[model samples]
Target: MADIGGKRVAILATNGFEQSELEVPRDKLREAGAEVHVISLESGEIKGWDLKDWGRTVPVDRVLSDVSADDYDALVLPGGQINPDILRAEPAAIDFIKAFWADKKVIGAICHAPWLLVEAGIIEGRKVTSYHSIKTDVVNAGGKWEDSEVVTDQGLVTSRKPDDLPAFCAKVVEEIGEGRHERRAA
Candidate 1:
């Protein structure tokens, strides 16, 4: 467990997020001493998608228009079929993710959430992993897709699925500890 005390992390999510993907990382990161906030397209709360059904709702800590990459040390993107699909269509959401990359802040995307990465145009030429179903999307986006529990390229971290959340969250904390990375080549 890395001591990320006082570090600020943002978990970008929306309705239909994979239940565990959002909760596990958020809880674990908080337990590791980082201040974690849930940022979404709207205020109030967002519903989650459990393995086979709609799961619990998580309260939003901040709205997308209210924050930026400069407000946090790291950013997290949790995936679900519906969540990323919807978020990827939002220009503001994509720009938020891009800002994190421009600043070289730690960015973590798992499962279908990599779709947001593809939309943000940050995964190109970077090594990453996501739920197997989204492998082609990642590769097509020019990312070096890997079949691994977790992959880290520069300060960007990615994982395959809920089963990989443990490694993903751990690496996120580690990357936050390392601070920002250098910009990637165009």
Candidate 2:
């Protein structure tokens, strides 16, 4: 793992986030020396959805109202059917994601998490991959969706599912280490 010793990464998620998707990359990033924070709709804790049922709870480090894209070096979006669906509907969350995209900061999204990216209007013309169920949504949003284990476009990193966590986390660390990327003019 690369040493991101002073970098700060924000995981934007809410209740019902996929358990593994949220935890795996977070633990991996933390182990690589990056400061990781869980930012959500509120303070206190948010629960995870483990496949069929509710999973463990993670403490909220900061609330969406209190943090901005400038607060971190990279932004992570963890996917769960419920998590992204709720987040995509929240204007604050969508705006926060848009700010990160506009700044060319590293943005990592997995599974259904890309829904937020689609909602943020940053997916058009970008190459990405996500859980199969949302393939149509990504394509409909103008993104070139692939079936690969992981895909990286500019500073954006995305993966297909929870099983792709190892590859996803590695690419995220690599991209964050590379810092901001320049997106070609549309």
Candidate 3:
């Protein structure tokens, strides 16, 4: 697999982000030389939810309102039901994600994270995967929802859940390392 080698990746997450979904990929991406930045709606720290209880707190590097999609090579959305749900309701958060699609940057979403995609109105006409519960939402939003553990459609890559993290991270790193292309930017 190719290394990201200093590629800047943005992870848009907030309180209630699934612990593994956020930490695993972030760690792997950084290990491969990607500069991972956690941007959230909060100013200080964001809490993570382990399967049943509170897990840990990660410092928020930037606020959603401060990010420009053009400054990143890729975008990551870590799912936890609450995280994306809250984000989907935030205008700035949705706009930040919309800018990523407009710029054609690699967009990686896991579990229920794609809810933000549906809210941003960018999944239509594309194939994607997410936590099975929201499969209908993807379809309803005009996206071709799939049952696969991972799906990579165009510049967008998605996965089912924490179990899919390995493949998800691998695909995300691949997308980021591929470099930007005009087709994605348009």
Candidate 4:
């Protein structure tokens, strides 16, 4: 595991997040020695969506209203059909994600989580991959969509689905260790 002992990571999600997508990466990042926090739209716990039914509930470390991108070294967006959909509609969530992008912080978005990137308008001209259902949305948003298990461009990391979690988590840790990226001007 990569040593990120002093780093702090934020996983942004809401109800309906894919259970494995959130938990697996969170556990791996913690194992790597980074402090991980779950930030959500509300206080208390948020329920996850398992394959065909609702799954586990994760505690909210901080409410979205009380946190800022400056508080963490990296951000993870775990995808579920409904999680990103709800977050994309949220003005605060969009702004928060954009702040991370503007600051060049390491960002990892898997599956439908890329939808939030689309909503934040940061995917333009970048390479990314997500669940096939959202490929068109990503391409339409100017992202170079691919079918790979994992794709990293600059400080941004994306993966196709739950099966890609291992690769996704590894790249995210690698990118975080690389520190902030200097995004090119449009």
Give each model a TM-score. Answer: 0.98, 0.99, 0.95, 0.98
Choose 1 or 3, whichever is better by TM-score. Answer: 1
Instruction: Single out the weakest 10-residue window by summed lDDT for candidate 1.
Output: 177-186
Model 3 misplacement above 4 A: 181-186
Each model's lDDT comes to 0.93, 0.96, 0.90, 0.95
Kindly list the per-residue Cα lDDT of model 2 for residues 57-115, writing each as its tens digit: 99999999999999999999999999999999999999999999999999999999999
After superposition, the stretches of candidate 4 with alpha carbons farther than 4 Å from their true spots are: none
lDDT of 1 by residue, 6-78 (tens): 9999999999999999999999999999999999999999999999999999999999999988899999999
Better of 2 and 4 by lDDT: 2
User: Which residue pairs overlap in candidate 1's backbone?
Assistant: none
Angstrom error of the Cα, residue 135, model 4: value is 0.3
Model 1 segments more than 4 A misplaced = none
RMSD of each: 0.8, 0.6, 1.8, 0.7
Residue-wise lDDT of candidate 4 within 1-186, one digit each (tens)? 688889999999999999999999999999999999999999999999998899999999999999999999999999999899999999999999999998999999999999999999999999999999999999999999999999999999999999999999999999998899998854
Pairs of residues clashing in candidate 3: none
Query: RMSD, model 2, all Cα superposed?
Result: 0.6
